[model samples]
Target: MRKFLALLMLLMISMNSTAGLVNAEADDPVLTSEAAVLMDTQSGAILFGKNAEVKMYPASLTKIATAIYAIETASLDEIVDVSEEIEKIDGTRVYLNPGEQVSLRKLIQGMLINSGNDASLAIAIHLDGSMDTYSKNINEFLKTNIGVEDTHFVNPHGLFDENHYTTAKDLGLILNYAMNNPDFREIFGTKQLEWDGESWDTTILSHHRMLKGEIPYEGVTGGKTGFVDQSKQTLATTADNGKLKLTAILLKSEYKRKIYEDTIKLFDYGFAAFKSSQIRKGETFTSGNLKFKASEDLLVTEPVEKGKRIVDKDGILRIQNGKGEIIQAIELKPLIGKKPEAKTETAPEPKQSGLLSVNTILGVVVLVGAAGVWMVNRKQKKSRRFRSR
Candidate 1:
């Protein structure tokens, strides 16, 4: 009984020690906010978050989806005439008066850069002949492509509609997807734009102080800002440090400063706390044999991007396969740019030289004649030698 009790205590101690190790690695200090999230844009790895799954108002952030839908369904150069319905929008005007004509490109800029509610209506009307149709299309697009299950769009511009709500995690994923589109990224990153005698600049400059050099952040790619009486303030930013790119989302903070501070803090924490490592690239990292149309057992090489360190020496690192099976001995190396001659190195030659040479009549006859004469001479020599013996 004494020995059994001792063994039980030892097992409990071992389990506690293992749990402590996991907790140590997973320890992320929660920031003061209604909700926030930081994620690696490439791998979708979550580094730090708070209330990320809680649904909240997205405010002008809805323009992200509006911009994506417009870019996809309409051409930039297509001309759109501002209508009376657009002129009636209640908030944030791009000063686009009814009867004013603009291109889709300018409308996108007005909607994204200026947060123009009027421009949003104009885009909606232009794209779908009515805000109702545009709203439906945007919702469908968000659900189908952006994977935002918790979001619904009542209008193209994010007004205080009861229907328009999104979680921090969903918003982060939406921004992540938006940033991949060159047009959406370019438009959202614009701090100021001048077109058609209308100039617009983002309102909360210092709140996004990194844009103005008021804060120290590397690779500060531009982002979007949103505010309302009900929603307070919200922001989404993307930053890259050459090694890894991260996207951060903050929603429903009391003040603009808080939003900016929280976003910066999230970015700093992500960069400092975690490191990204690419395990494979291109044709590499695939399991089992890969077959090509014209080739067999195609030669393969591993191309790993520079991995960012997520945990310290005191923390634990866990890697798993697609099946949730932990992969042991996983090695990561920096991915170098492709060498110009990498593809040609092992490519098959047009024809086999030795086989082609044998097919030549002159080559075959010379070899056969040489072999025939040698055999005759060797036979004659053997016969003479045998006779002498």
Candidate 2:
């Protein structure tokens, strides 16, 4: 019977959660990009999405994943022997001469800051023996570490490959994951770097206009740009206000200006409409008799108007907007032990009879015992003094 009730409660929560999202969708900003997603970096909540899940060519956005994957799996200071393969890369190049020795960190800077295809190939080959192995490993890494689905990469750089594709939501997830790492964040946000490569010697600048202040926006932090004939123009951007951090992914914009405009609009909407809240560790939520608690501090995104947290029978926490629209859901673990309040025992009132209450009786006995010890000590001291004289 209890199981049945739990199931019924779960069904109700599911229904309510879906209704909230549908109602909230009416306020989402329309965009010109073929696919777009705005995600809260702190909470991993999708603030707005249009065709977010649809599979599309990621172009150079693939490098964002590559850059992060390399950062986590290997040391940035490790030296890499640039291969002859870089000479064959048709797109952007850092102009690597075969067998040129470069630090892993510099290669990543070139790949992300300058969109260097040659640099990407060098990093990939250095990490894994070949592109085939790199592709397989990166796919697994994205799924296991970042928790992104529907993303696949055939190359380290975002170049046109019919098989190389990812969703806007996945890219947003990747950027959010990457931004958490200090190393990745520093490299991704880099605007310009002096390149003293074997063949190329100049300052390389970030292609993303907003990131470089070419197209100004408040709170812009890190960004990546990708384009090929197949994937018109793709961008990944991260920004933070004092109140909230955000990741925006825009894919397949017909024109470069349109993609930047869409990204700006997305950021403006996310900042204006939503705010971040946290679920503190040990905070408890109840549904009927079932109880759950946050195991650690968990950030949640909500509308500026404020929202309510609803706990389902299964311990799923749903944050709902003022209009009863659901914006984010988090899994809460079952509480492990009895609550502190439950362990407390209330004392019974003292009896009305002449006899002292138990606590008062104990206190009197303790005082008497202390006095007796003091008297004995005094007597012993007097005897010892007399004997010494």
Candidate 3:
């Protein structure tokens, strides 16, 4: 009977969630891009999407994944000797010359900051030693590590290869994952970086207009841009307004103007629709004797007054909206009070003499000294009396 009730509750929750998610995107902005998505980066909630899952070319937005993968898989301080492969890359170049040495971090900076294709090649060569191996490894890395599907990468740089393709939703996942890493986020957000390399002596500026202040948006934090004849234009942008941090992905936008327009609109919609609700660390919820607390502060984005906190038998906190959709499930860590630190059988300390105490010992010492003085004076008096007799 209990099982039946639990099952019934789950079914109701599922139905409500489906309704809520469908209703939430009902008024999503009409985007000019073939595929686009807006997400709350902190909560990993999909606020709005249009054809987000539809397979499309991601163009240079692929670099977001590449940059992260390199950061994790390769040593940033490891210096790589530029190879002939770097020389052969066609699109953008940081003017990296063959046989010249540069740190892996510098190459990543060039790749992300300047969209330097040659920089991508240099890092690829240094990490896996060949593009063929790098391609296979990076595919597994993206799928396994970043947990993205419906995407395949043929090259590290987002060039127009028939095999290199990703969806807007996938790019959203990639950027969100990348932004979590401090190293990647620092490089990703950089508006400008100096490239004092063996060949290039100039500063590499970000192509992202909003980040660079070419185009102004109130909360525009960081962004990446990409273009090819077939892909048209692709953009991955991030914005934060105090509580809420959002990432927007635009793929196959008809024009450059359309992508930015769509991005701004998406961010505005996210900020207006949702806010970050944080559950403080050590906050407790209980199921029987199993008390649970959030390991750290928990964040979720949803319209106000719409959230429902549901704790199950297993200590999982499924936070649903009023509409019955589970927006976030926090793995509530089981809080068991530390086993009264194992009542170890420590032997009681041996009893010391009462005289061991300061006052008692001092009193005994004074009494002994008084007795010795009295004996000495009596003996002297006796000796004097005997001498007198």
Candidate 4:
């Protein structure tokens, strides 16, 4: 009977803790794309999202993940031998003939600049020996490195495979994570390259109109485009306006023009409506009577109008917009000292002493077990921490 009562009290406490977790929702932009997300590159905060979590085809955006994984895993100077499989791969190509030799650095340039499926396949096979192995490696790579949950890439090229799919949120996360790498930023931003391949030898230009100056947009850094019968049109773009760095992912647009329009609208909204806010190192916040402090300087994205910052009892800081809608939540380190609550003195009864002892033992066992499990998991999957430069 005592154990049951104790368990009931724990459930109530857990429910109460989450009661005010969600605040008022802020107004979001209207987009024509089937799915879209606008993220702040510095803080990894989602400024805007429309069906962002919905699983959809990611077309050439898969290459962003592939390029970064390869760049970090293999030496760019290593030469890769092209196999006959390149001929079988369809869609865009750098026109590499079987038995042709190309440097890894050149393959990445061709793959990203020209959206070459053949280049992607060659890099995949060369690194992992087979497409199946490439799929497993990249999936694990994204999950472990980029911390993506809703992405599964069966091919490096993002060709139409029924099993190959990713969400706009995941793609935004991937691109933001990749942009941090200097090598990836260089290749991804290249507007044009003089191609000298086995079969084709000419200048190749970026398919992203914004990056190529065809669709003029200031601060356009890097972009990738993808399309297939099943996936429709997909676009991933990055930009910086001196004050802010932003990443936009749009998926399953019916027309090419619509995606670009959507991307521009997102940038305009992000730059105009949001700004970065910071918590200095050692800054303290209070929730009820508990206190927490920032272990390091922390950056967050919020509306330009200055959102309300609320700290929860668990030491989480939630930044909310003017309408009281949560824009971002950051974890803070709890202070070591917390004064215990004052208790009312009561006369002890001999008859109830045994029951009190049993309840105390039960509670201690449960808490110790829970804490041990949490510690083990925390040690195993420590999340990557980011700080402003």
C-alpha RMSD for every candidate: 13.7, 16.4, 15.2, 26.8
Error of 3 at 103 (Å): 1.1
1-389, model 3: which lDDT tens digit per residue?
99999999999999999989866632458888888888888788877788989888877888898899999987899988989877678888899899999998888899999999998888888888888999999999989987889889888888888888888888888888888999998999999987797767998999998899877898887888999898999999999998799999988878898889998889877776677888899999987767888899888676655666778889898867556877667788888786666666997999877657887878999999999999999999999999999
User: Which stretches of model 2 miss by more than 4 angstroms?
Assistant: 1-26, 322-325, 336-389
- Compared with the true structure, all predictions reach lDDT values of 0.72, 0.91, 0.86, 0.91
Please provide, for model 1 over 1-389, each residue's C-alpha lDDT reduced to its tens digit, 9 standing for 90 to 100: 99999999999999999988754432355565689988777666666678889889988888878898889878999999888886567877877777778899988888877778888888888888876787788888888987888888888888897778989888878887877889888877776665553333334222355654566667888677788888888887888887778888888889777777788777766666466553323322322232112111221111122232222222222343223322222232222355665565677767768867767977889999999999999999999999999
**Model 4 regions more than 4 Å off:** 1-27, 337-389
Using TM-score, rank the candidates from best to worst: 2, 4, 3, 1
Candidate 4 C-alpha lDDT tens digits along 22-124: 3323346678999999999879988889999999988888899899999989999999998789989998999998989999999999999999999999999
TM-score of predicted structure 3: 0.73
TM-score per candidate, in order?
Answer: 0.65, 0.79, 0.73, 0.79
Clashing pairs in 1: 274-309, 274-310, 275-308, 275-309, 275-310, 276-307, 276-308, 277-307
Instruction: Give the clashing pairs for model 3.
Output: 17-324, 17-325
